[model samples]
Target: MATVTTDPFVGRLVDGRYEVVSKIARGGMATVYLALDRRLDREVALKVMHPHLAEGSDGAEFVSRFRREARAAAGLTHAGVVAVYDQGIDGETSYLTMEYVPGTTLRHVLQDERALAVGRTLELLEEILDALAAAHRKGLVHRDVKPENVLIDSSGHVKVADFGLARAVTEAASTATSTILGTVAYLGPELITSGRCDARTDVYAVGVMAYEMLTGRLPYTGETPLQVAFQHVNSDVPPPSDVEPWLPAELDVLVCALAARTPDDRPVDAGAALTLVRQTRAALDPAVLDRRSVPASSGTAGAVGTAGTDRKSPDSGATAVLASVAAVGAATAGASRAAVDRQAGSPAPAQPDSTPTTVLTGIGPASTAHLVTTSAQGDGVQHTLAMSRGDLAVDGPDDGTPSPRSRRRRAGWWWFVVVLFLAGAAVGASWWFLSGPGAYTAVPGNLVGATQAEAETTLRAVDLRSTVKEAYDDSFPAGTVISTDPPAGGKVRKDGAVNLLVSLGVKMLDVPTGLVGTTADSATAALEAAGFEVGDPVEDYSDNMPAGDVLAVSVPEGSSQPHSTVVQLTVSQGPAPVTVPQVVGLEKEAALKALTDLGLDPSSTDDYSETVAAGLVISQTPENGSEGHRGDKVALVVSLGPPLVEIPNTYGRNVTEAEKMLKDAGFVVEVRHPQGISPLNIVYAQSPEGGAGKTAPKGSTVVVNVF
Candidate 1:
């Protein structure tokens, strides 16, 4: 592996949108980064494939796998699964944008704490299996299930991530390659033996994880990769109780069954596994199986007995030795000869001269010691061992040769080999048996567009069995087949099963009608019946609508709605009217208060009134009993006094001008001419009112003397 210098996407932009922020993690085939989605205004985790992994000869194959797996994962709508938002290639880099989970992986947790409590461990395991169950139902098998692929969020939500190595069980067989898949520690027996995998394989991995969680150790260990792989294919998993006796037997059985050497021997799928786990957890008492109560020796060293004697107990020292061997084998499987030479133990029969010396150290004379060394040569590498007990030396040939005391020491190794061989034979026989009899194949058809009966018929004609899996499809017709397993042209045994995905169709909803102008409660009932959820209704006064009537709805009537749509109603509070209070004879302050109490505004106009006292209400607009709206202005006419009068006499002036002058002087104009007096006609009819000074109302009519 080369050390990454500068970030791969220092200046590159993806789809003219996402800009890489920083490299977050790098795996064997891809690198993940924290990126900014310029369009969505949010942070996203971007996974970019390595150029070699993307464009090499294997690139096309890997890319296809990636697309299929990503699509399947994206289709899942579970809280425990990371959401994939977008996927595309920017130049040479193929990347996927996903929800940025803010937390560490289970690997990080293990690295930090080494192990967790039983409750916490079970909680995390349950979440992981839940995610797997969802994926399995979608026909997605996460080939790579490991601690690093399981992410734990800050809120303690465990999400399964990294479906890059996932395989769609319905796809073509041309996709399967001979290259090793998944972490060796979690790889299932069938997967290691024949490269065959399915939901059961995933169950096996989950079982391995569960075992590790409880024991803080893997069930299998060896000095080489082949050894570990062989163990998966042959060895039976020692019950977790062997390592953690406090773990319930029910849980141990589940884990052990999942790690069974044959797929048939394990649970049917993730669902079955989950059911078993739930049942086991429900039936067992955690307090009775508490780790603190178990003896220290019975906990971590349960598989190894006391006094260093090779006991034949079910949880025996041999099981522990085999597990340790498998672990070491897996770790050194891909290493070079020089690397293998550094491990403990002596050389096997295949190599002798290359074997290294082994030594044991102890604190006291009573302590035991064993020799461990590694041997390497051009042909292969081997493990050698020697045990010394105070001058009693024990050495054995690498090829299971009998030592001086071989009769006793050889029993365990011989038994282990027999178990390994029998397990391998059993798995092979099961596969052969299943392949010949119950195998069935069907061509991939447009399940989404076909009716359920049509899909069943199509599958039946091909001797394939059909199982309808209901799902939501925006594009496919409802009650039709969405897709089929053993894709078109793919071959399966004659009786093999074919799974069909059926569409539930687009969700339909009725439009809430006649909700407008209805009361809040009435509208709520109507909308609820129409498959719409009703929100709180708002009220407002309207001048046109009657009080307490429905004014309008949030969603207009006749609109199609889905279940749970929130509809808001606006109810009318009335025409803003107020009952006018009577203020006809009250004092000015009292009259104003009365008008205000009726939600009406009052203003006063003062005048000199002879009938009413000062500061008293004389009259009011809209008469005192008329109804008015709140905040409406009302004018009050307060009497100041009777009208004042001014008298004027103009007999000699022009008749028209005289009338105007009289009118301007606040006097009533009257013209009277006597025939006899011409010269003094202007003064002939003059009266004492000509110069009269009497108070009257302004602009009031007055009597005038004219000739």
Candidate 2:
């Protein structure tokens, strides 16, 4: 049955900017996807944490540690380290946007080749150690050092990734059990036994990786992770030479020391380990360094045949010559080995070269004959006769020697043949020195790392013609020679063309369009993906742009810049804040002036109040000290004051009539009767006379006396 799997985040935009394109890989804690930072329009790797790891109990702590450690990883500025860009939490989904390295993981390469050549292995291992050294100097330990975390780019640059992530996860683990959080095969003894790790712990893992690379097998194995952890705690690591006998003694010593059960027994850090590795590599003989261990199951013949296939051939004609030379070397090697085995009377140690042979002969299709004599083992001269198969016959009795007369007859022609051979050698030697292959000289001196002019000059001095080819090289500066077609010490004929590969510096990349107006985060991610580093963004207030949006960039969009250039981004801090006008006590005109001067729009409403004079300002909406942007409206309430009326005198009038007079004056009216007498309808007296010049608030009441 086939299993079906789908990625839910594909084609989905996160935080309204990153568009996940495709899934790259899935790990225990997160699934990494290739995403496009749509606003900046460049690709990035998006590692989204699994939902289970981002929710439920202890999730917040895990998320917090993840963010803190991610920042620490970002601080690592080494070229051999992967750069972390951003970390964010959206709802229940926690994701980290990081550098999208275009290459295969070390694990993938190991799967294909099983084992690597010693020189190549050392080169990659040194790069890994370089990254670790940078981290260690900053007081950060990777905790997890395995092939899966190592990346080899297309240009053969190695980068170590996932720095500090394993430690973060282990810190957040709920249980205090001895279980470790990384690959069990590479765990150090201290981590498995005491749950403690340090820089030396990383060195131990590297040692394990070195052993695996050299022997094509892990030093320990188990069906369960716990079982593996137990072995790391209890058992001592064996030397790689135990599995691969061809490995040199120095390599075996290095691996064994690194994989020592005690952390104190190994190198103190990656830097210490690196020094020892270089020393050991330098001490190895060239033959030992070049020897590759072939799998016993594949057999020697199969390994040799696979090496000569089309897949391993180079584009240069020199490879063809080398192939022929290798064939001749194999033949001579086989004949020598056969003689050794026959003399020793025992089978020699198995060599991957080829099966040994006592003699080599071939019969021609045409009716022709040729005789060649060569010395063989056991004090005897053997004569090789080549003829058409139809003319050849084996009529000699088995194990019987030739007659004495026959041998004498053959000896009579020996002198004639010797003279003929000497004459041919003399002629061949004359031609070789005069105009043949031997007259050609070697292309001298190392061309790599030299300036193009220097390489050209060296080539010309050696009587070789030079042709220039340009390529991008991260390590080499522009105008320097990266390599040569005939290599440094290879031979070429006089005036022969030697192609020189000149470095054009790191590849140039164009800044993507639409960087402006996007959020600063998207722009930064885009710039980083295009091989440029983003400096801290400069923040400024803009009248028209919203806060947190990009205003401009130091480098314009659509311009080309060398890889890893620093680009400064200008981001808006939103419109300038407008101060609310202090118009509560000012008159309408005065209030309007204050509001307009502050770039605020003002409007008014009217109401009557006893405490305030007419036409004076009462209060304003968006009150004093309230913040508003430019051109934002502020509403004001204006005062109309209290109403004035003439109080009517009720001395000669009835209570009801007097009350009506006072009530019509915008005042509440009241009538008073004698203490014990029945109330009368007419009023005899009132508190205030309703005449001109008396003023009161519209709701204030007046009292009247009744008779």
Candidate 3:
């Protein structure tokens, strides 16, 4: 049963182009009416906001938002999305004309059926998500997503409606402290609190709706709308299986993840959510999807049980033939009734009775009414024929004579029977030859794994023709038969062509040459264009490759990979810098070990030092605390003990002579007097004195006594 609406504007015409037929439904924001577009001569649903909502400041603001959002929604074009035809204002009322759909809302369906089968629920949700994906692509957010907004037609095709009405109401209620206009259960936290909306906001609403669809109940309920809104903000949505334990765990995981309290937890948009839903649906067991236990009397027989129309008799052609035969039998019975009327001398036409009726005829007053009538009734297979002995009597037979002509007349019926028999045989033979078993032959044996030549030979052997087509197949080998058109063990007419799908082997695509040294996004696009799929990238430090640039590909360049194969990319983390270790003042062996531990190759050289001990490092190349990569070589100078020198004897020589002798001995010369000494004077005696065969470093300074 449908609700009857009789508003004052039911018979009014708006904008002279739309004629209002009748009000269909009333919602919080507007009343929907079934109207005719006079200009286009098509039916449309006219949603007109209440005049009171267009009066005050809040109402004015709501109407303004309605017009804007309606136009935005109208810009969207998709099969699953309900189209907005026009939006305008007629006098003080704002109305929008949209595609008039003949169907029930998802809310009505849920109310009637309570819960839907897993397959049906997913089917509906997929289409709804597709609609949302289209809107999200166009940068539109359907702030309200609930059962009430989704419409399912007679064919079970879903169309989503009422895209922007909920948000308009929210904007109108902004000034009021105690007002909430849409379904609080499906409202996102941001929409309820700050009236802000984005793609994720719609994702949240869809999650809540999905929960209701799966469990036949909402995740949250409250006495007041505000309480339900609070629940969406504060509480985590329980798993759908909590209400119906038999539900699949995947469904529960998807719902809980989508309905997360924070915006970041949900899918980036409806497109992403749709992908997960399709993947999850493909993994579900057939038994789970096919489960249905509802009774016909429960008002849910056609909801998810029957997909479209009901089945009648086995086929329609047989029913038509039977009906025609019945009609011919009725006409013959009518003629019999007319003949009986003439014999009985009744002028009134005979009428068919509900049951079989009897009619008797009399020739005169002395004659008996021996004509017993049996009416043709029911299926006409069993019918009555009026007959008399006189009707079959012949004039020659009355003379009690057995004439040859009378015998010939008796043989005429036999001739007619023989003709009928021959005619029936001809008809049956023609039917069999043209359309029966003779018209078609059994297809050849399996060709799925056969070679192309072998399959063609088999098909030709069976009196069938063959055509070949090539396609890439991941499983079958190249040039082998993947499948046949009529399929193996199927029927095909003799000489009919069998399309053989020959495998061309796996599809191969080369890696894009321009992918190297490019950003990940650019590389991904290039790879996809080349028919390869981009896999997760691995990060590593490179000495030559810059950071964030592709360092290497899993498949070498110029090599072919199967189409859609995941190609892993290695992105560079820039050069690997090594810390130069401090190796000076340490033992040569210890210094070499320290540098090697720091990933630096160490080499040592022996050097003589006057002040440093032997067997220790004097200095290192590249110095300490300098940047170098791993495996970089470091050169270290080791100290040998101070060089020993021999001193010549100068005690018997003059100051000048002793000074010259000491200076020539590879030692520094100094002049010393008792009080003051001349600048040019030389030493009289050396401090270590007159020692023989002493050697020193070439640049060493020596002191000599001078007078």
Candidate 4:
């Protein structure tokens, strides 16, 4: 059974126009409700920030940031981007309404399909990048990019959601101490180190997602989030072929370049990334693009056709570039190569040599002799790039001869440098304690929206202590910091305490009872008076309840709702009345049944009609279109045929005589020549044959046969 999560905003009108029907979902910053735009009579997804966040001291700032981001996201008009309609505040609740997409998220899809085929992954990524490119073109970056934010609609079309809301892509001015809004698994190296983010950050995240989609597992996993984060900063995201060696070299190059340790190696932005990906896709062979993807954990390596691969595959580091990416993975990588191509202006790349050498270069220090060998390909294109760590590499020939005396000379120089370092360290320590980092350090700001642990870590780094206070918040997740005591960017003495308001989760309310006996207006007023929001009244036909009176009421399962809680009331319209239908000119039985079916009492009276046939209704009381209750009396005058009359004998008589006789008998004369037209104009037979007991209605036609 689904846990009933109560929502206070349900059945409540926001801004006097949007009616909250029910809660749809809750995220880190807001609770989404399926709401009705009363003015437009359409449904929209309404995102409402929890009271703690929206009503905090920084509420104005949060709202301003939210509005700004929403506007930027709204500026993006694309089929793949979720549309933002409006943003506003009602009382203390900050809300943004957007298009309501009905579908499962890409995260859910990944949960079912451990790994998607190459063609399918490429297809999804193309659409995702297409949308991201649009935002990047507008100078907007979706700081958070992951499968969870990708929505697959009912028709299988993709929609990217939570763009600017996650956090706008900003310059790398801040550091990791600020509230990092994206999933840790997909955070870029720049994002992990500095609070700053740009289009490249999104590109990095997309690269991680692509790796996960193709490998069925994250590139890095650790016991703690911090461990994984450490690897993201310090280690290279190995080629996907490391796990599944059958994967093509282009894929390895693509993933490595996007997930490069530094931002500069990756595509400049999502647009650049998209351009690179499109080119790679076009260059990829069909067999490789549509190849079935098996999880790397499956331990199955097979010989199959792949981009620039031999019939039999070689493991990663042999045929493809290792974890290091240098020349490719950028929009300019191709153009730079074209500039050096033997055949200029050609769409296809030039054949360099028979072997492509993928080199691995270490950043910073500690290059402990790592060598990667490459294989020769039939394509005869040798791609070579080499970078050396001059300082870390040993400077000696392979011969076992005694080296020059430079080692001893270098050792003497190192000793002299150490003496100087000791003298400088003594001076540095004196300044470090006196008005330096140890003596006075600013409190780490940017704690709001960060997790409690993360805030504490940041404070610890800045020589400040943290104390957390708990409160209920519908928007912020449990254990999430809702606000900071001194606000972000405030200065404080070293080791000072920075208080935090942490969320205990959303609050639930008591369900309102005894709504069936009161009038709709009474219930609505009472609910509204009790700090609850009233939804539009629902009406239905009821036998016992009087019109405008309450019939039923619906409440959420738990009391997650607080002030502005939604209250739904069902009003009775009383018993439905049936319209009396016209029975005149209808068959007696049909007319009677029609009234009976409508719940009206049907009764008939016998009468002779001159125009209406026998057993047909002539007139009805309480005429057609008049409303009547069930079992209401309906009087119908049924015809008993016109007044019967005797017909004169026309046998062996002139046709004219028979016609005249029928006319005199108050019947219409219709002469027939079944026998044949008689020269004597004699009538051979007549309808009813002028029988003694036979009679017809007055003005009814009579037939006479002439011989």
Candidate 5:
């Protein structure tokens, strides 16, 4: 009943069986702890409900719901769903034990990275969808599906957790409520308006998550929870492309459709939503399509093309179309120059036309022109050009016969070419500077076998430096140079450092000897002392070695192997033959103890034997002193001693006299043919064929085979 606070109950023993190790997570209703199940020798996540909440009027009802939900979650076997192991009450506390998953939540991932690449983001999303779809098929709805509820393992596997809030759709609570119970960011509109929820509701939340991942921001924001809830009820979800224009429009539309205001407007269910995602993903790129093998459609192609067009050139008026095209072309050219500079390990190049220019050119037929300029400083060649009459002409400083329009066009084009030339020159110079230096060379000498410090001093005389990197080699002596980076005769850079790989000497160890005929434990200890690990020790019944002694150590004595290699010891359990002990004529307990002393269990059978005393062993299986191994069953026959006798002449006696006589003889009486006229009540027939039986076991069924 205690509430978990900052001072959690970690390392506390509970019920003398479980020890809490650490708090794994806490929710509004319960705290989960990673605990050691000492009795089972395994780790478990124990979710303990708050004590105060457990005592409320609805407490019993909620407890029942929690158990039911936990059982339902446990029934699921998907790898993406966390496995529930056990649930019970420890004193007054209610806890459910589950598999412990070590990982961070998707919420933590989002908080740390803000955004992930599209491929990684989609992969995680699809895994979440797969888990949800499975849950939906089982008629369980996970009321909360958000970043915090999704866990990502170190290996990049995504698992859905915390199904405690899930409700079976057929449950009365789900059909009766309209108010929301989950986080506002992921709440579906129907959950707010009508208190109704289904699989589509979860699909809507997944869509919201996808939107956030693509744009690095939530689709909706409000001042308070109520305001956000209201938005879910009234607003239409915007396409992700509206925020990040680079996102594929088909994907944006699919995500928006999932976040639709009405549940009916969204996909049919989580399964359908997953299908749409796969189909849309497949149609976007051939690689995705081939891997997923979903068919492509014309509609998908057109949607992608439209998205590209919308992002190509922002200016749209017919009069400015030509100018816009030219501007886009220049922008693309500048982007290429920047890319080239980046690849060449240089700073980005300057834009061709930092400012736009308009000009008129040609003497016969003048035309308006837009000019863009670029600058390069690498290769040192510069040229300029002018445009007129739909033709771009090279311009010269000495051409004197120039119209005003031609002169204006020539001036702008010349400026554009000069800028590009300067940018190209700069890119070239950066490439040359980065790729100039090569590895350092060693000066001619006997330096190949010199120590690292000696080599450094000699290399410094040639304007080079030396860095020693160590390695193991058999051909080179320890602490001696194995090789140099540039070799001895190669050309050396004036300021480059030579990297040396030195020898650590050949690997060698003495072969272990004399391990046979010793105990496995002793052999293992000896091997470990010699830097070897112990492998699984094999046991066999040996003819030559005594019990619990080593027969031979694997990897044989005097045979060299790697250091720390596992050496397996084969131990002897001794010979297989042994003699069984005699237990007959002894008391049953004494007989059992005698067999047990020989490492055998006495298989017992009880019988009445006139010759043997009561409670004594009459006989044993395999006879006495038979040869057998340990664990062989030894059957024993214990005696009850003597049998029951029957009453004589009871048939002719009166009823009372007969009953008393039979009772005195330890015989039970039964009247036979009571309804027949039989010599005025004198008995005529008796069982045991009338005095043929010698003795019968007491309490044995004496069926006068009943007439």
Candidate 6:
């Protein structure tokens, strides 16, 4: 029977800004969706927390933690970390908008290939550790560190995601009996017992992941989640070389040190782990790094795109690369016996890396199991506990059948299990061939914003062709995609065509031209004719143009530009006004030179002055300090010698009359030799001898001799 699922938010608008396009993935904390940001005209991943996580004030703690995801991921802007764009609560829906990465989770890859090449595994894990290192340095710890939290883009670039469980190192501790919120497989023992967590906790989880990647299986597992937790609290992770003989000693040491049952035994944090990993990678022989553990031909799942609807070729530019790893479960009793043989001085004494336990955890204790969606393993999880030394036991009902350890000891029974698996696959193969890989696919979601060439490449990756049509779209840049026929997310045949409309940019219009020397009104008319808006006239000085005449246009003439672009006209305000400098008390030639330098016409006129000296400026017509244009005129006054005055013929006359005569002649007079005042007050001697031609300037001082 087919199961039908309906989503209320699938087509709903989120907070009036994000338009939910399709569901991407679901996890223990939230459901991820591919959404369109209407405001930014871009796509994003919108993660909406489950309603049960945050309902209202009662869920304040949960809500706060949910919101902290944004701050935590936002603070980490490294390329290996997914970016957060926005976060808010729209009614009861708390959501976060993040950079939409077109890729698959590492868990999915592990699902298809079972294990990966050692080089590829390290290449991917390095980025994950680097991102975690950045977060750890920022005082944050990613409580959940597993394959599901790692995203690999189509280009094989790795990005760490799901900071939903991230918290400040100070706030990482939680009650052991409470939620105990983390996947059991990666949880450190301290997190299970003491409810204490720090950067070291994340480092421990990373070590488990490394072991799984190298061996294609988790380190421990149980029928019940508690059994897994029990192992985490008691056991130590073994070296990967035990299962995959090709693994190197360095990797074995790294995995063991990272997954040590004692928290103090592991690296201090992801930073320490990353340094060790880099050193190990550098020192390892190239042949070992390049060695393939499991080939892709072993039940490889083709590339899966966003929402699991679209398919991509392995070599596609935007293809999804998954990393799927099975859970740690009980090893066959035969393998366990082999391990015991090594412990008896076969491989030397058990070092710190060797312990009776395997490094792995399941979900929290049964009390908190309802909150978890994943076990210690990823999707399609299986229990294959890879142990270094211990009993291969799992708890279940007390049936007549033997214990798991007893059954596993009979390695010959594996033939029956293999026959059963082959039979089931044979029956399912018919349905898959009819309706799965041989049928339809969801149109790629990345075509709406990609370049024409890129969109075509994506289409071809899915065994489809692209048909492009040009459009005059102003919203997107030229040569970029505008829209697609049938749109994204719609189902189509595997061999169908994807029609695309590419933008030709805005409609081209002739630029504002021929505005110089024209009137402002005419310039405006010309701009309107060119399909442009005329902005306010900009005034500037132009020696050749008159006021209100256009001097230039903002845009170049005759150039093609977008229609209705605002073009400003530069209008001439005749010529800039020149300020007349003060020329008062300056020499006549200097004053004339100053006026001429200012581009003003200088004129001179004669004048007699008592205070001003001759050949020097006295005052100007337009004042010494006034505003005038370059061609305006300024008048200067040239001084002539004071009018000549004849000396009075009163040498022998009365001194009073001589003084009066001197005064009337515009001269200052003074009496001499008149100490006691003579009876007639007559002049004793006249210095000029009553000369009529002797002259002196007006206001000149004259002396009269008196008896």
Strongest candidate by TM-score = 1
lDDT by residue for model 5 (255-368), tens: 665676666556556655665566456545432221111112331211122232321112221111111111110012221121112111111111222323322221223543
TM-score of 5: 0.44
Put down candidate 3 lDDT per residue, 228-267, tens digits, no spaces.
Answer: 9889887777756444434444565567656767776565
| CA shift of 421, model 1, Å | 33
What are the models' TM-scores?
0.47, 0.46, 0.42, 0.46, 0.44, 0.44
Question: Against the hidden true structure, what lDDT does model 2 obtain?
Answer: 0.69
- Whole-structure CA lDDT of model 5: 0.62
> Candidate order by lDDT, highest to lowest?
2, 3, 4, 6, 5, 1
* TM-score of candidate 3 against the unseen true structure: 0.42
Q: Which lDDT value does model 5 have at 160?
A: 91
For residues 1-707, what per-residue lDDT tens digits would candidate 6 score against the true structure? Answer: 01113667788899999998888877766788888999999999898878876554446666776677567778776898888888999998988899998878888888777777777878877888889877875677788888888888989998888664445212322421255767899999998897778888998898888877776778888998899999898876665655554454456656676677776556566655665576567756676676655523452222111111222222212222111121111111222222222221112111121112112222223211101011232222111222221222334457757666666654433443355446545533643444333344557888987999999999999888889899887678998997665455443556888788999989888875667888999888878877788888788976578889988888898899787578888999986799999887888999999999888899999788888888878789898668888778899887875766787777678888888888888888777885666788897776544476787788887777787
Q: Mind giving the per-residue lDDT tens digits that candidate 2 earns over 257-321?
A: 56777776665677656655675577555555655555555533112122412211122211110
TM match of model 1 to true structure: 0.47
> RMSD for each model, in Å, please?
16.1, 17.2, 24.3, 24.4, 25.9, 23.5
Off by over 4 Å in 4: 1-8, 168-177, 296-707
Cα lDDT of all candidates, in order? 0.62, 0.69, 0.69, 0.69, 0.62, 0.67
Candidate 1: which stretches are off by over 4 Å?
1-6, 168-177, 288-508, 514-556, 559-707
Cα displacement (angstroms), candidate 2, residue 393, comes to 58
Q: Model 2, which residues run further than 4 Å from truth?
A: 1-5, 174-178, 297-707
Model 3 C-alpha lDDT versus the unseen true structure: 0.69
Name the candidate, 2 or 6, with the larger lDDT value: 2
